[model samples]
Target: MINKQYSITQAPNYWYDIMRGVEQGYSIKLTRNSEVVAMLVPAQYEQPPKQNFWQALEIFRQQVNIAELYDENVFSDVRDRCPGREVLL
Candidate 1:
């Protein structure tokens, strides 16, 4: 990850540019009085990894019964729908 630093005084004026950089995948370091205080990154970077289909099913099964969790007919109508592309990995 790219790292960029800015002081508290400079941060307010350049906040938007810093956020845009973060959106483009940079990690920003914000400082106060020349001392590092905080770091900013995209939400996805802080989120936990997503479970695969089977793992998610298992978790749901543990919380509820298989009858409630399983739905074979749920995606029946999705075959004709358009599948969106992945934007980020």
Candidate 2:
């Protein structure tokens, strides 16, 4: 699967389109200050049809701790503070 990136400023305007692409198998990387802050990948990537407990724990460890560490809107901001790059996929 291919991966694409969209800045915080570009995301909300294209959120629906990005979601559609993720459903179709493209992994979308959401960026802030040119850094990948989040990824919108297919649900299948999150949990396979059947996975062992150990494998599941690995995925859990890689996840972000938004609930305990930061505000929910921290990454959702659409402000253009940092310069963005053209992410072609």
Candidate 3:
């Protein structure tokens, strides 16, 4: 990939030119006072590997042990039974 540098001040004037360069797989370095502030490059769109519902569930089950995660004794007293403060109308 070709790399080109342009000052921040020149960006507004050469906006389309810079975008065109990026579209053509060129990397554009935007600089301010000779220091690079940002880069413009071609966007890469990657689709995640698709999984069926059953396959996904299997993977989840392997990672999480349901027996240890949902012990009834551990969850029995999780919530307070007391009613909250009553508001006066």
Candidate 4:
């Protein structure tokens, strides 16, 4: 990657130029008082690790609350039981 450095004060003025460089695979280092404060580089896409069926299920179980999932009382009054008016067609 092409590497470039700029002082904090100079970054704002060169923001668009720096971004264009970064888009073209340049690595930009922003310095403050001669110390490196930040870096802007081309983003990399990585695939997350795959989980097997049982492992995925275990994760799902850990995140869910069993009592909340099975709470009948919470939903008892939610549905409207009345029949709707009949349509012509």
Candidate 5:
């Protein structure tokens, strides 16, 4: 490969070609005012999946709310045993 500097154009076709080069073997650096800001790595390193605060909350939300809180068979029996009380589940 030649030591020719390349410019990242704002064209879709050019972007596609750049992505292909990146996939093959290329270094893409995002600079702001000639200062390096970020980059698109040629390949991603192996890392554990990340879970943000909301994502962790969502994962916890999917867990069972209560074991016998709303069991259909036991619900009616519990209701009969305790009447005039609000069944909030």
Candidate 6:
């Protein structure tokens, strides 16, 4: 199993434009000589859920009826028609 942080940024299953590799993508045997505290990665946008969490979105992905809302602007019809599924609002 892959760790959540590495899976998103380093793994091929996620980001495409890889800028560089982390520590040459290798782990040296730690012998109390390693000098490090913590690490982190940059965030991505709009990517679907993976591993065990959902991606953070800026806006609502669902569709709305424009005629019913403004009567002038046409809203998208991207409705979630999941049958027999309990969805959290």
lDDT of each: 0.87, 0.86, 0.88, 0.87, 0.58, 0.36
Candidate 2 per-residue C-alpha lDDT over 1-89 given as tens digits, one digit per residue, 9 for 90 to 100: 65789999999999999999998999999999999998888988866487789988888777956467767687777777887898899
Could you give the candidate ranking by TM-score, starting with the highest?
A: 1, 2, 3, 4, 5, 6
lDDT string, candidate 4, 1-89, tens digits = 64899999999999999999888878999999999999898875235788999999999999997877786687789998889889898
Over the stretch 1-89, how does candidate 5's per-residue lDDT look in tens digits?
32112343332446776677678766666445555565555664346689999998888778757554665675565454545777789
Cα TM-score of candidate 6:
0.18
Question: In model 2, which residue pairs have backbone atoms overlapping below 3 Å?
Answer: none
Q: For residue 76, what is the lDDT in candidate 6?
A: 48
Residue lDDT tens for model 3, 3-85 = 89899999999999999998888889999999999988787524568899999999999999988787678766998888999
Best by lDDT: 3
- List residue ranges in candidate 2 displaced over 4 A: 48-89
Question: Who is ahead in TM-score, 4 or 6?
Answer: 4
- Candidate 1 yields a Cα-based lDDT of 0.87
Of 1 and 5, the candidate ahead on lDDT is 1
In angstroms, how far off is 50's CA in candidate 4? 11
lDDT of 1 at 14: 99
Q: Is candidate 3 or candidate 5 better by TM-score?
A: 3
State in Å the error of residue 4, model 3. Answer: 0.7
The C-alpha RMSD of each candidate to the native structure, in angstroms, is 14.2, 27.6, 12.6, 9.2, 13.7, 16.1
Per-residue CA lDDT of model 6 for 1-89, tens digit only, reads 11223333233543332324332342212112243333333334236655432332323224554455664334445655568768799
Over 4 Å off, model 3: 45-89
Give all TM-scores, in the order shown: 0.55, 0.51, 0.49, 0.49, 0.33, 0.18
Give the higher-TM-score candidate: 2 or 3: 2
Provide the lowest-lDDT 10-residue window in model 1: 80-89
